[model samples]
Target: MNHGDTSRERGRRGATAHVDTFARDHLPPPDQWPGLDLDIPTPPGQPGPPGLRHPDRLNCADELLSGPPADRPVFLTPAGPAWTYGELRARVDRIAHLLTGDLGVVPGNRVLLRGPTTPWLAACWLAVLKAGAIAVTVLAQQRPHELATLCDIARVRHALCDVRAVDDLVRAEVPGLRITTYGGDAPDDLLNRPAPEGPYPAVDTAADDVALIAFTSGTTGRPKGCMHFHRDVLAIADTFSRHVLRPRPDDVFAGSPPLGFTFGLGGLVIFPLRAGASALLLEQATPRQLLPAIAEHRVSVLFTAPTAYRTMLDALDGHDVTSLRRCVSAGENLPAATWHAWHERTGLRVINGIGATELLHIFISAADEDIRPGTTGVPVPGWHARVQDEHGDPVPDGEPGLLAVRGPVGCRYLADPRQRVYVRDGWNITGDTYVREPDGYFRYVARADDMIISAGYNIAGPEVEDALLRHPDVVEAAVVGRADRARGQVVVAYAVLKEGAARDAEALRVFMKTELAPYKCPREIVFLDALPRTATGKLQRFRLRGPAYPGGDQQ
Candidate 1:
């Protein structure tokens, strides 16, 4: 109720009061770490321009249309040849006109996009934005039922899909919706059609207008749509680029995240365009494909998850990656060993951050100069972060608590009461457990929902996973909590060994004991050919918590 405590001391006291009274009984002490300078210059209360004005102007196509024609490539897709910025802009403009004039699409319309990471998908996304319509990019791997639910929730009337997914789209049976197909060797009738000449009127939209709707992993329940405004794109571009990436106009960006995911969108599309740079879009971001794309495109900035980075390093015996200036790892907790290995091999520290679909992008990330390996790093400019207890009170420094954030762009879920659970008193409850050091760096614990209580001692899954990853035999590992009658809940690990490595449970148990506290060590290790993952390649820990694996030991 008393939200006007602008004084730093008063705010800290107020936050502390909330935590001590409500959340302290449920959580652990924050890990002791170095402190941060609280006096660092904070950005303006609301850093970016107020509201989403001229949503039409934020489209990449608009920037391309007004910029000069150059020989430089704007986009390079594996499905087809590259296109210069000038040429890409022209195509986007023509497509935008067709959607608006011929297809009867107008400003504020919701268009569902279902496809792989192809050139056509990228063009359609930009064109939808250019037409002032909200683009909802769904993962291609989603089933028909999932697609139907998403379409209904977003009120999608038009869908742009690839031929491969047309049957699924049809099976979805979305009422009163129209579907269009693209890609393959067939000639595109839309491209050769007459170009829509002269300036089409741009829609006037505020910063708050929903420009895109990104859905989170529906692990707990149905996926919720996280609405991001046009300004949200710029917010990430400004915060991440200024403080973290610092890319130049000439820098070529490349990564493995799909175009639909925020990581890929920010790194491949928005970040590069914001800086007047270029992106080499890969339809298939396999390790083999990605490595060559980087070398062939001379990619300077690389963005991906930690697992991918580890895979790349293992496969990089003769890969030429000298052009790389920066590598960013997110979507999962980054192990310190991964950071050290990358730095040793490439002479670059992988910048680590913790972001969510709700926040639109990374809210707490470190710059190259400020990185502390294994930690998620400090809050970015225009954002405020605090580790708070269960009752929404600030936890003590070095203690783990819910990571709360408030920034220029916050969670605005469409028509969901779950918004109350995430956005409380203007702070976004990130559902992640973290510890803020005295020096300001934040170390990741586990998701509040993922913490395992064994013999009354709370353990974070990632911490154990981080320790296991350091072992020579472990290539990939997932730590999860399994139900145990004796201990309430216990830590269990699913490990995937590197090629030709023998997996011995007894030996691994010894390995973990030597590396971690006895209470934090995995009670059992199950060797698997591969860990189950979401479409985005994130390890699905929920699957491991099954009846078959009771007592944290595999049957």
Candidate 2:
């Protein structure tokens, strides 16, 4: 299951037996996968500089606070007062000393961090790196079993967590693990603690040395830990900051993503810290709270998902969001209507990007100067993207194919044989299906794994889901291919209606027909109380495809 094993050995050992079996029996032959040529025109310009090459040269605590205004704010929270760069650095230094001297955390040790997003949580993230230990930030919303699995997989020895979440971590029964609890706010006495003497030396880590491990859900039932290095963190900042965000050092960054999710970690911490910009930490980033915080803080840059944007737009009647200069959306596709509505209302275009846990952060994103609505835009600087056929061959232009990427960072799955299916000939095969336009922008299709073949024609699940969502009655929708003997598979829609909405199936079916092509319409509709989702807010499609649904054909 390690990186060194070959595909044949993996198959023989039954390492990924379910995945192998599904691919063998269900997927089209390699030759049948579309071949598309993607020679999209590149915008004229020299590429930006490479991301951090030397890990020692970049320290989040020092690099972010160096040469800052002595009185300027570094972090702010509702429960605690704002701290300046000088104050944050001083607190981080003391915490670093406590971790190194008292807790005995040293370079290369893995420290599991489990807590809600708070000022103390932010400081602990920085202090863990400052102490030269690898920080593994687990989602605070995760169930105990999932947390335990992650602790065991990462071989976490020491942990920093909020007191509320400690019992769950302890219940997981990770062997030989020591846990330390941190209060929600930094105490005044912490700064008086000893600073452990002279300059703290940076760990000598290469671009490939594992610095963080973020787990992502596998196509199968298990989750796979995606390993990243110190350089990858800086690489994301360098690429997205220079080419996509283009933020000034004075810009204020804020977001709703959990600190544990790489999206929030990159947007709220790494990107701003790497660029010497300040981040406002929100203990609660709900739409109600986010709008007021933006106005109160004069935040310039915002990061969130499409759902959040829609919610914010609905709640913006009395709030002043004009100070926000940029808004970035991920975690799901940005519908054209959502994009248009936001722009018509705010005069700011919502930048859309497609990033996966394996790639660390964004690799495909649209810059402000070159945004094409409804497209994922061009590859970020220092990366290359192409559409490949099932045989792993390059595809023709404007044809849907598997998106393959080669860049500063690639994926390495944790002890999973499915790594071979994802990484082929050094290119990371993002399971997304995409078409490259003549203009070089990538238009996202459905996930290859989620495509629906209905009545001898291929249908993308997201396409139908998007159409269904346009209906006023549908609040959320999930489309899956249901097995049918007559047509091989049929499109089925699972929908959650808006509050107090009628659940008349015939009326909804008629509405869908007018919105989408006849072949693309859902053959069956099932009203659901709620759709299951992971802690990170991604839909658990596999759960919908289970025996309870039984091929999706059942109403």
Candidate 3:
């Protein structure tokens, strides 16, 4: 289990173990990268927090999975029985052998993983890292065009896909990419291939070596590749999971996010594995499926979005959910109403967090007694956060400004010029508009781009949407600014109503006038069956501002 070499041979800035250097070559210049506060020496004579401290020559996968007791269950799924740590290690070792021996995968090569959430898919991800390759994990349901774009950006050289999900990847037709399938009887299947047995030694990658490349979910425009190092993976588990979530070894983790999403990756895989706990890997975890699974499996920790929590509340009548002790909400703002409702019903505080793909995982969050219903909690123990203006100067409390963060983990876009925009003056400006209360809690405003300016007033879309969600008949809501000739823009709302509820836009507007300022009320309401969302379930606000509106594309 030891992942250390002599400091003289492999220090933090010493030679890397990678054979291929594509990831190292593609990293943004050191000056352009956000300040990584990983190993900076503490000021003379001052004590430091015991976080992010690891050997210079380390592989996170080796550290996470190598030392657990041989017979403890690490993964549980409805499709089959639990996978003990011994079984998982055997599978990962064999896969690692196949990766290096048969697949000709060298260190630093990028390996794409496309599959539903399952033990086999998780094993592939670990094998890629154990072999010193960069993992590019993506949604299995992504279309060919999206897959092609991602492969082109990451220059993926190999892929291990579930047999059911390999067609779109083959259709992507990425040149020079080798595809290997699993979960089938084919001679070329990854797990079925021959390999040396027992334990496979882990690659001695330097702490700063790129271990994975995560892409932004394309919520704004073209997705950007984010390069994360081996240490970054463990940093999230140490800072948030250790200091905040505090999971025990016996806890059973469950969640709705896919393993490809960083939220899902942390909640379902990294956190549980690091804590020596078991996670129930679900391929399809909607509200309907999650409720029953929680009751049946005695799940202690749950992770999902605000929308899912609200949906589950409606279906909670007959389900026995006392097994859940921790519920986390992210991927979007957790409206105060939803938080209060969930807390009242389950007697568990919903930990609200705000994170970005660029930062790897949740940077700001709260748990237990530290929970604040309406605000995203203070920065995790190892991180620092503040409200700052565009000039990178701190803003006063109670004023809305950009959320600036710097910690052991920060944004490092792979060869993208937007690096200059995301990291400025050593701080990762999260592009989130937030208000810092005098008491130190960070309040969610909206995405900086989602702010609506009408005439001379500034408004946050989430504020209006939160007000609309208070209506008993409203099931879902998304607010955006539509172009208007008089005011520069007008507030417009898209809402989904309950089955038996009236769909009168005017009546809803009248109700909103009572809850929000008149200017914040929706000028026009668009009724829809469901709000538009990306494959990852993030709301697509731009679609609501299309060319149909007057000032849609403002001058």
Candidate 4:
């Protein structure tokens, strides 16, 4: 397959092939894709998901950049630098021109994106979309084999990479992939060179054209690419950002999730741009660093996981976070204890959301008024979320069941048969356990795979983790099912303590007994310096499974 056009040939008027058959060739067979549930309404009786389909052709870059508030600032760096929509649009245009003229990128081609979250990376993503190529943005931390797997899976033949991390790129061993570095030798680097001068037209792409291939963080095994269309890309911004986040032009978005994660892409980029707001990008934001950065940048909207928020709570002393108006949590269950503490200290309600890479962004989320502190909130406008039993039938309210949702966006995996497991009977069954209230709020229980069935008493790991976190001594906690000959499985908890705090597993066990039901209390409490987590800050409970605990084993 011809991956992209030749530079000289592409430069000539009407000389380009205009289509990359390689990308088109790899799309999952039509029958394998989940039937889009665009007609579903939000929690019933509300209007159905709107703008479910766009007419003929529309490039996301053109629509988002040329929309209203084009002259307002849209991007900000930690060093106080900012880019208005007009400037960012110009840069995207120039980059798009360079992509086609110098790099030979054309419509339907696949462009591999790598690097930390930076303005240049963001621009490259938009530029790829603007040039009509599918952007396959992988995590910078991906090793050689992982990178190679994704490249081959997506048929990626070109890359815009950060050369500083050369180990993986050099070792990926993907044949025929021409790599272009961002910080290459003076004149050849894309980031260092000036964008070619010209008004490059954004590709006139079909609304259903695949725009991005965001690979999921596969905790179970190798990551699978979740293909998203140009229309689905904008659908998230319109539904979640518009209906739930309600970000304004004055809001300054901040977050720790890398743009490689769809969570960050929406929170830090798409949401802000769609609302005509600016975003503050932090390359290395830890608990110690994030608080000061938030105070320094005067960030208004913060998006991160529950773990980071808890850590930030620990490090909030001497930090002024009054500039923050909204805090969005996802990637894992948001414990009510953490939410209560943050609200107690900041007087601002944290907007919790449940989203996945497959859906593009958030589906269930609530902001200010509709928020129920302990729950994951209701479905974002344009979505329908329902709890279901093992049989895929809807379960009554208050019964913990698998979470099944459908909306304008749904799972559309790239060449992966796991699509059937995720989407059934027109519903995207996100592998999460939840219980809905009569009031329409959805409470997160645990990942369906993360549940611990000890002697037939079904237990949610997040519930036990939440109980563990309430104890003042526990800084971080993860609960998992450990194999047991007697009870089939037992709940084991791994915890991290505060600085200078001594390990007291027995005291934590006793404390947990008081807060939780007898069966729900963790059978084992293990003290570790830290719980394992993904680079995106999600707790890797799978890694903690079967760990021997130091105390509370009353066998």
Candidate 5:
């Protein structure tokens, strides 16, 4: 292998970087992309600045890692010493050198990154982008077959992984993946390798160059990868984090999401870095661990799901959460009860937002004075949103319809025919049903497909779930439509009971009947220890399509 630069430079200038074109090969047809017609919003009353450059000229790594104080700590990890920006920069540069020089990585090469949210994992993500390669990040909990599927989708040949977590991946025998480990005893461990002497400049590539290919679990349970350009990375930080969340240099951010999730990447990595703020990462950021850590680290900004906020509400009494200034809720609907309960206890407002992997991070959200507990606030600056019926015509205020938005950032699926399903007539149809009030706040209705048609009435499961949660005995709930011979489908509910609460399904059904329309009442109720949820704490309604509790039903 030659250590020369001109050959690699020629490769970078080519239509596709390196020999790995899986990301490009899989991009949906250009005409199928969501219409990015909304102009990027300028900061209110700010001085004139640099004009928006063509996306092909932007390098997100430079945007996030370039200007912070070198000695300031950017992240804190439980596994090892925290990283200062200076130390983090050194590591990123060295890794970029190793990848391009010795490991034969070139621009656009798809590099698989697997591990918990640690400093090394964070550094590896940045390094891949700095090397002009696209990063394919996956969760640590994923089993081999899932990893195999991602590997096939990405056509990945190289992996920079944590030895502690990738045993399943090593055994999977993915067709093209070549593995390299960190934090291992092996002599070839990538983390232990020495950095090349001197400086390393990040790759200069088109702003539209694919930087990350993030895979998300859609309604079908199949992983759908969203391709984001280098410019999309900074665009998310600018529109959502800079404009809405409003972080400062001194603020400390924390989250429950794995960095593999776009929410986590934006909340726990990109946003903080963009603001010159500090971020706290954990392998396990569940409520059980987060409460104490918040007090211990003085975490001011929190990013997590509504279920986590509900869980943290139970554990916050002893832990001093006085340090938290802002808590963001997404991934699932924020039950009004959960939002009110957290505020009553913590005196801190939980910001409600709706975001998708296709569009990057939180786009519809409100913070501080703008927060309305149950409503996902107005479109963040730089976006346009409206509610439309199934026929794609605008619906009046206070009526439920599909939520569609066109903005600076929007969906671009990786060669999936479902691209047509998500983007229609130049708008991204977020698979959600929402009611926009006259005040312009968007209320969460069921998913566009989650509505249950029983007999003649169309009922939203969230409405019934909300009513049931009002009963002190119900701690958690999920309602799904179950096929029935008498009715096309009936509303069936799965609920988790507060300890020692009555398990009588009849009484619970009676309570729901009083609060909701008779047709919307749950036809059957089943009790369980806990409701099934994704790692991000989203209720997996599909898992409850037929069975209530594991096998059949638990009436």
Candidate 6:
């Protein structure tokens, strides 16, 4: 065989460093993929945005590690310890050797990384990409069934898991999966594996090669695996982190979302390294744990859900969180009540955003003085968004319609037919019902499935939840539509009350009537100690819409 023939054929198909082509083979057909604007040529003599441009050969892990100074701290723990860029790169090199040499892994293999947020887990992710493998990261809290489902969808072959969190992975018993445990003194431990390395060179992969597959956090049905490219990882930083969040080299980033969630990955790992800043990784990031960690680490940037921000307001008496300069909220809609309360108490405006697993990170956001309390901000730089009707036609600025967006990065599902449903007419049709304001800001209404129609009127669930949250005694609230006899569907409220607060459903209804119209009021109220949420802190409204309980009654 002629050597030129083999090399030229691979280039003709798609330039890649992957020896194993499973991920590439399973990608959606070119016709099913969303329109990526990166392939469009820039006009002559006119320059494009710096972050949107990438060379034919690229590895994102290599790019992120190249820019920062050697001795700058890149990873910080809540306890007293830090890892400089030099130290992280060294550890990553050693692990890359262990993966390719000792573990017999090859390029394009799917490596599952399961663990809590720590320096070790982050290093494994970077090493996998450096070794020319596709990373499939799942939460450490995933049970055996969930783990198996994710592994099956991604067709994972190998795993580098935390020793303490290995039980579920073992129990999942995915066929043909090889596992290497870390954070233990065993001879077979990943960190203890034998390796010979000075500096492990990153794989020379194409910019469009698949780097990771992130499964959607299931709110309704099966989770679809969203495939992201090497350049897509850097695009989020160039657009959102560089232009909107505006991270500084001296800033310390912290968050409650798990690293498995793209929100946490962008905020905690990729953005900081890309910005030459340090990030504080927490294994447990509940609101109570975050308070002390924030003061201890002197965290300047924070990311979490709207509910956590509201809960922290009650417990902020003795904490010293003055180091916080910028705050970002996503994973769920941020109510106007929570935003105003947080501003009144701390004088910091919470930056509200809307992002999806398909899009990887936040695409619509506003920062600092550009923030409008209730509306999610305009499309981020390097992206375009509009409100469109069912036929993919633009709606009036003040009308509620589906939000469609197109940018450098868009959805590419892995061998899934839902790709057609998510991407239509060159736009990623996000299933959120929204109204584009006259000033171009987008206002949240509800999920397309969450909208309620009762007695010839359309009602948005979040509007009712925001009204209920204004009540002094209502600590948490969720609104869903229930089947009714007269009306096709009626609004129902699930609420959690504060300690010593009366559980009077009628009084709460009257309070809501004052804040909203009569038809918007909840006809029934169910009290629970806490609202159900996914591991990523997203509200699970599907669980609330299940069959009514024994004592359930209309107000």
Better of 4 and 5 by lDDT: 5
Clashing pairs in 2: 35-395, 35-396, 36-395, 36-396, 37-395, 37-396, 37-397
Query: Across residues 260-353, which tens digit of lDDT does each residue of candidate 3 receive?
Result: 8999999999999999999999999998999999999999999999999988888999999999889988899999999999888889899999
Question: What's the residue-level lDDT of 83 in candidate 6?
Answer: 97
Displacement of residue 211 (Cα, Å) in model 5 is 0.6
* Residue 124 error, candidate 3, Å: 0.4
RMSD of 2: 7.7
TM values, all candidates = 0.88, 0.86, 0.95, 0.92, 0.93, 0.95
Compared with the true structure, all predictions reach lDDT values of 0.75, 0.74, 0.88, 0.81, 0.82, 0.88
lDDT per residue, candidate 2, 1-555, as tens digits? Answer: 112223332232212112112112322223222121112223468453543444434444445445567677767676667777777776666677887887877666778888877767777777777666778899888777888888877778889888777788888888898887776344423333445764555443433345677888434567787766555677777776666787777888898888888888889887776666778888678777899999988899998887678667667888899889989998878877678878989999999998988888887988666898879888886678889899989888899999998665667665556677777765789899999998889999988889988777989888888788778777678898878889988887899887799999899999988988899998889899787776666677777877676344354
Residue 122 lDDT (model 4)? 91
Compose the digit string of candidate 1's lDDT tens values, residues 249-303. Answer: 7898989888778888888887887677888887778776788888878989998
Error of 5 at 43 (Å): 6.6
Off by over 4 Å in 3: 1-12, 39-51, 548-555
Q: Please report how far candidate 4 places residue 80 from its true position, in Å.
A: 5.9
TM-score of 3: 0.95
* Poorly placed runs, candidate 2 (over 4 Å): 1-52, 55-70, 184-199, 217-220, 548-555
What is the Cα-based lDDT of residue 370 in candidate 4?
A: 80
Residue by residue across 1-555, what tens digits does model 4's lDDT show?
121222321132122223985644555555444545444344454444556556657678777787756578788887756888878888888888888888888787889988888787898899999898999988888889989999888888889887776568879989999888885686878866766786778888877677889998866677888988787888898788877777888999988899889999999888887777889887786777889888988999999888888888877889999999989998988899999999998898999999998898889988887888789998887787899998889999999999998776767777777887887766789999999999899999999999999999999898998988898878888888877889998888889988988788788888998999999988877888777666677776766663343433334
lDDT score, candidate 1: 0.75
Candidate 5 residue 223 C-alpha distance from true site, Å: 1.3
Question: Where in model 6 is the C-alpha error above 4 Å?
Answer: 1-14, 39-48, 548-555
lDDT, candidate 5, 293-372, per-residue tens: 89888999999987788777767777998888888988888889888988899888888999998998888989888898
Worst 10 residues of 3 by lDDT: 1-10
- Segments in model 1 whose C-alpha atoms lie over 4 Å from true places: 1-70, 78-80, 184-189, 192-195, 548-555
